[model samples]
Target: MNVGIETGPVRTGGYASSPERSGLAKFVSDTSAVFVREILLLLRDPMTLIFSLLQPLVFLALFGPLLTGALGQGSTAETLQWFVPGVIVMISLFGTSMTGSNLLYELMTGSYERILATPLSRSSLLVGRALKEFAPLVVQGLLIVVLCVPFGFILHPLHLLAGLVVLGIFGIGVGALSCALALAAQNREWLFWTVQQTVLFPLLILSGMMLPLDTGPGWMRTVALFNPLTYIVDLERALLGGSFTDPDVLQGVAAAVATCAVGLVVGIRRTRRTA
Candidate 1:
């Protein structure tokens, strides 16, 4: 009865109203802003966007039809379906490699040093840069799907989602690796092209991207087994209704994980060293 006299409306403010979670909110806000800025920068580069989008289309148009004839009847549809994943993988690889050029550009202009001067975490800088590549890769992957629709390729939405996941993972892994390499590059400008050609051409040819591994010799098959890109392309193939063995899918997942692990370690070390 005596306690009833003290009852009143309680007013809570400051920490009681909105409690801080864990780490610095300022860091989260700043990193988010940086991510948005990077995405905008990528959007403004029309030529880069166009070239990135068109390269796969051109390859699809030229090589897609050629492989159809090479592989025999009904192979056109099969080959295009096969090429869908390969194109996504190729685009991811190409798109990620461009990170080197972007970083190099920043370095040349002293912008990178300025970024390093900020209170940003090195990991955030690395991740933010990689996030910049994700949107374009997704766009390119969707474009490939659209282009394939007219060619009689029907994709289940679930499978498409799975394929996109694979592409996203591939993009991140490749982008991280490329960023690390770019940091170590003495001449990032010229080395960008060199890395693209050297790393991509073989992966494209051997990963069953353009043709089946059965078309290759024994050594090439062995090489394909070890190539991380092979797993990416094969995973896409499996999702697209091509005949992919269980072992193939498992191998691919393992390879992609390994590549990603290696890339993460390298990217983290490189960022710390260079920053």
Candidate 2:
């Protein structure tokens, strides 16, 4: 959670020389530096690093087999096809959904303001953090897919790649929104936590990350149709399972684009204001 911590040292004495760079070059350099810094911080804590990835493995270990058995006369292949997609989506969502708390910590410590005082662009700052969060989320997601390989899950190469991109879009959206929430409720920990808890579970349910909507009650199915995440999950499952037909994948792409687009707008505006 070292959102603004430096991973290296710098010398700025009377004898230290400053190097000149072009605008685009400087922008890329700064963004990449922040991105790497966030990554180093993420891996610095052994416990947090492990926990960020362990949930999907836990679910894969604890539920993969059980889900295979519980799919109601469904074959092993069918179970994996159905289960792996949801698990992948869950990995991406849960891995970085709570990153807002890290932002809050930085705010309280004044690290956020310190970073803002620097020359780094606010968009770069937001993108760096989002990309950092996306790194583990994507890794965890692929790990989930790999773990499911033994559980009768089959991978379609192109579809898997497409699914990963969709998962990335979803993670970026969630991470951006998380940052917005943290910035909005900078001093209101209770409200922040409450809002996070309140929105997260319902969204999880609506996304059908743990259970298929088809098997759920009629009301839940109806409600899930409205959730953009529902389309995301549906597309991932379809692609992973090699059932890519009709409008599911297209709908998912559209939804993911829309969600992330909104996230970028809101995140950029809020981040500038917060800074």
Candidate 3:
């Protein structure tokens, strides 16, 4: 039986479907409405969006010329081919890692509880947030890649697709994990950051975002082998060079999928329980 109500939406205007709507249809509508709301909230203060890009931009400005030039041995093109993808990942890392703070803020302000009272599936809320992050990150990654063109960075169609795919997987996983952490921690802000910084910095460094690992110490390379970001970075470099059939790319994609799936499931489960 189609069990949706024909009632007015308490929030997310007109999001609630008619009373006769199917479960799947209602869920889709709710998720979409939630996604729109999230986007609108993000857009309301465009400065936030600009600031979000600031860190990566600063990193690129301060570090790009020096490191990329040195790394590529004066070949600016090769430098960007290595640097751009790492910048993308670094952006995702900073942006999504702190999503839990938003949730915590909502919870403290009673907004989250009100949202919980809505008839929409809790997973829709979580998924909507994930989609929100995914969209911008993709655009940001693309824009950065495009802007690098004048500097001699070459772009491949397949590389762009694969890079976006990898970043989407990374964003969703990180976003889901953020949500789960927020739910679990509730109002404990410090705990979230403590764990986040500990985990995040290691991943970023292990990824060798600023330096090539090929000449690094044996043990460091061995340690990086265990990090999923390392493989993703490897795939990005491969894609930058217009090669996609490498085994490492496949491994990286598989790792990304697994990580995203698991985090989403865990987050969805936690949100359901909270509801």
Query: In TM-score terms, which candidate is top?
Result: 3
| Candidate 1 lDDT tens digits, 108-164 | 888788777765667767767766677787777888888788887777777776667
Clashing residue pairs for model 1: none
lDDT of 3: 0.81
Worst 10 residues of 3 by lDDT: 8-17
Which portions of model 3 show Cα errors greater than 4 Å? 1-14, 17-19, 68-72
Q: Candidate 2's error at 133, in angstroms?
A: 2.3
Which prediction has more favorable lDDT, 1 or 2? 2
Instruction: Note the Cα lDDT for every prediction shown.
Output: 0.73, 0.77, 0.81
Tell me, by lDDT, which candidate is best: 3
Q: Estimate the TM-score for candidate 2.
A: 0.85
Q: How do all the candidates rank in terms of lDDT, highest first?
A: 3, 2, 1
Q: Which 10 consecutive residues of model 2 have the lowest summed lDDT? A: 9-18
Higher lDDT: candidate 2 or 3?
3
Q: Per TM-score, what order, best first?
A: 3, 2, 1
